[model samples]
Target: MTTNLILTNSLDEIAEFVTLLVIFIIVIGITYFSIRIVGNIQKEKLGRGNIQILETQKVSNTKYIQIVRIGKKCFAIAICKDSISYLCEVDEGDLQFNTDSSISKSSAESFKTIIDKFKKDKPED
Candidate 1:
């Protein structure tokens, strides 16, 4: 009878250990997945903020160009039927043009219109 009791006790201990290990593994998996979800949420928030900034700063005209500025640098991005082109910097004091030949006249006109509107709407600093 004593030998039988010892064997039963050992089996119970092993079962308890396995249960604890399984619980620990589950907890760790949940923690890892939680961190990943939170990180993705933060990245999406940052991307949305950037898009809002771009939309608010965009200028569009029917006959001329559209312009958007990324931070301090200005870009004269033109939109055509199936292509996009970057013309020249419309910012004052710097007359730089893109060396790439892919830029079209329609794009230049659109960029010029956007820059002109931005200049007009800018508040004095």
Candidate 2:
């Protein structure tokens, strides 16, 4: 009966090893899927970011001009490591930006009407 007991013990050990390996594989699969989900979430956010960079032009080495759209208006900004400055506000009629169909934008009004309103609202010096 000693040989019979030894055979039973070997089978039990093999079963335990198989169970542990299956558990390890499941853990690795869960980790990989979770990482993929997180990456997709971050990509979606950047794709629909509110502050859109329409164009950029690099001048010199570090100095660069960026045309950015903030809400309904667009502005040009000068970016550098030490300081950042707003150069001017670009009229929306001047440049057109290509956007994804997923993003919703408001209807555009006539540029002539916008200019007339700006001149009327200006305060005399």
Candidate lDDT values, in order: 0.62, 0.78
Off by over 4 Å in 1: 51-125
The C-alpha TM-scores of every prediction are 0.41, 0.46
In terms of lDDT, which candidate is strongest?
A: 2
Report the C-alpha lDDT of model 1 over 1-125, residue by residue, as the tens digit: 99999999999999999999999999999999998899789767865642211211123542234454566666666665566677766573454445443242334355667779999999989
Model 1 vs. true fold: TM: 0.41
Residues 6-30, model 2: lDDT tens digits = 9999999999999999999999999
Error of 1 at 38 (Å): 0.8
lDDT of 1 at 105: 30
Q: How accurate locally is residue 108 in candidate 2, as Cα lDDT from 0 to 100?
A: 25
